[model samples]
Target: MAQVVTCRVKFIPLQLEFIATFVYVYNMKEDRKELWDHLSQLSGNHKEPWIVLGDFNVVLHREDRLGGNPVTLVEVTDFQNCIDNCGLEEIANSGSQYTWNDKQDARIFSKIDKVLVNGEWVDQMPDITAHILPEGISDHCPLVVQMLQSFSRKENQDREAMRRIQMQLQLTPLNATIQKEEKELSDKFRRSIYLAESILLRKQSNLD
Candidate 1:
């Protein structure tokens, strides 16, 4: 059985909007190909900033499985082909690299869960990441999709705010009572500059 749900999402704080699709798949080897084909067709139909994620029940690479039967090309081809055809790429992730683990003594682990997004999504939210939480009693780990505020976006907002403050300071006539307001504005402008520099340094370090 395979299920798919798609919806429009509005992130109010960031004012970011996009289409998100969730999929849950369960299929045998023969049926998996059909599922992949369906997903590929679905991706082709969507042109907006879109994200698709959930339990895919398959892996894309040999290293995604550990302490299990050696991964075969046949096991990965359909899923790889689907991703390639869909023009989707997995987002940056942290925490557990392997998302599923069998509880048995001879534990088997695999990364069958994934969060994938289209190029539009990447362009809109390049800093988004997925954090794989501890599985606990469940065999599959919980995935937390984090939409981080990009440094560029934050810097732009800060600069806009500072510009508004500067304009107000320039328009206001100098007076004894306005001295306090001027000082406050100056402090705010300095703080904004410092914050922008910090964000730039962090982005540079990440790139390095």
Candidate 2:
């Protein structure tokens, strides 16, 4: 079955974080553009830095191939177009370059696995990089993706706004039962109330 895997890296340089999604297609020949379009839609909706990686089955160039019927010229062009359209760049591949192989031929290898990142996310990863690792039990090799930390102002503001909204929602009972003493106490205990409100908000949001 085809599968999508994701991992998140947070706070390396200053306060930047990234969510990386890897798509591993088993035997499907889905268009590369379709996959990139899907990723683009997701990023537009979330408005967060994203890294997309995995074995796309299609190679972007002849340099990426090892042996045996290489990916067609048309396919390579399509793959390149997909990467360009998605606004993602391929990260460096390391170690034994080839990522996939056929059991029958030891020399049959191909660099199908790849690591891609959104251009906006480049600043967050200062020193870290992505590379291809060795294959163990499977035909495909594992990849190592190193990430750095850098915080964006947008994420911080979003969090703060969310906190304020949560605080307002938690003050519901206070509006209904505005006892003189209760209101006075609530005003005085603003810090404590905010903390309590935030905790509950996180919990409720998680449930939803």
Best by TM-score: 1
Deviation from native of the Cα of residue 87 in model 1, angstroms:
0.5
True lDDT of residue 37, candidate 2: 59
Q: Give the clash count for each candidate.
A: 0, 6
TM-score versus the correct structure, for each prediction: 0.70, 0.59
**Residue 48 deviation, candidate 1, in Å?**
0.5
- Alpha carbon lDDT of residue 197, candidate 2? 47
- Stretches off by above 4 angstroms in model 2 are 1-14, 31-33, 148-208
lDDT string for model 2 (19-105, tens) is 878796545455445665566566666545678888787677777777777668766775676667667787765688788887675
Q: Candidate 1: misplaced stretches above 4 Å?
A: 153-208
**Lowest lDDT 10-residue stretch of candidate 2:** 147-156
Global lDDT of each candidate: 0.77, 0.63
TM-score of 1: 0.70
lDDT of 1: 0.77
Cα lDDT tens digits, model 1, 123-144, are 4443578999999999999999
